[model samples]
Target: MSSSSRASPVKWGIVVIIVSLAAYYAVYVLPRGELGQAEQWRVLQAVEYDHRASSVTAEPKLLQNAAGSDLSALGLPTGQKTSPFTWILLNSDSGDDYGPIKMLPQGQSFTISCREIDDVSAKVVIEPAVSAYLKSHCVR
Candidate 1:
């Protein structure tokens, strides 16, 4: 075969490989990425009261005491640096988009540790304080 004719086969092979990769990404990787991202968001974020305050504010905050609804604290072992509890301040359930969040350990109370940012909520991890709080409260 002539030199040009030989090159045509190589070019066609490259095109085929690229097309196959693209197809695989669309078929397998796309849906999984979407689902995994949403689930990851749920696990990392805990939908908070402030974001959805409109409903509560209109009713002047339902002043009800949880006399019997609190979870009976599970018996956690001693000397545990981290508790079974995880603190994640989730966005509102109106399906607000949370871009990406990363947990960074900071020495502060759990409430103040999380610094909310525009589309990024990565400021989630708190240090020894978080472990202490987790040992006490089971509130998600």
Candidate 2:
């Protein structure tokens, strides 16, 4: 076995390792510039509201009132007469896209917390009712 041939595989392996590390950092470790703090907060709040609203059969007025107060305290205005429940479903892999769960009333906003569970899935923590609603209507 020639020294040059032996060295070739090592060099390729090192290059592959470097590229893999770079991709990992780019995809997971690096902060997403696309989602600013305010946007993230909104997404989170929306999910929480949805989860909380879903748990109870009655109207989610208390949950909505609390959420509105929280938002107001945070200096974000809650629009008038909006639904008490909001849904936000975060894509585990992508930082760019999310939508409300189907069962949630449209235009309600809640909070969401997302952590990557693996390469393919994310652990999303939302409000209790929102989570229940999602489990019933959206969980796969």
Candidate 3:
């Protein structure tokens, strides 16, 4: 084989590897990173997914490790009249059942629990606004 033929495969291999890495980063990392309020929602989703699928505890710290980004400082809504969703409460449960956030008040909120039967279940009690948005976006 000529020198160019040997170099061609190596170059193609390098290109393929680069493309694969780029695709992975684009599809996985970017979407989960901090993008304002969406960051808060995605973090909650990932935590709930983890809780339902494999854990009884839903803690926010674990998200930073999984997403390759520091989401530890991500704050939840405090119902201060910023947005429609501006008053949401974030509840988490490590027991067999979710915390009683529904009875809190008129403000919106969600819970992350682990009383799920399968991985296909979602333990995150998404607010109506978030759920509706997901439905409209076809993100079921």
Candidate 1 lDDT, 1-140, residue by residue in tens:
78865768779999999999999998777545655355434333332222222221111111111112211111111222342222232221222223222221222233222112211223223233333444353322
Query: What TM-score do all the candidates reach, one by one?
Result: 0.26, 0.25, 0.29
Most lDDT-accurate candidate: 2
RMSD of each: 14.8, 13.9, 15.7
Better of 2 and 3 by TM-score: 3
| Order of candidate numbers by lDDT, starting with the best | 2, 3, 1
Give the alpha carbon lDDT tens digit for every residue of 1-140 in model 2.
88765768778999999999999877765644344334445545665554542333222222222244332111111232344344333222223323323223445443322211121123223444434443454312
Backbone collisions counted per model: 5, 21, 1
Residue 60, model 1, lDDT: 12
lDDT of 3 by residue, 1-140 (tens): 78855768778899999999999988776654433335444554554344332322222222233234333211222223332121122222111122222121234342322321111124334444433332342312
Model 1 lDDT, residue 26, Cα: 85
User: Candidate 2: how many backbone clashes?
Assistant: 21
10 residues in a row with least lDDT, candidate 1: 58-67
In candidate 1 the C-alpha lDDT for residue 103 amounts to 23
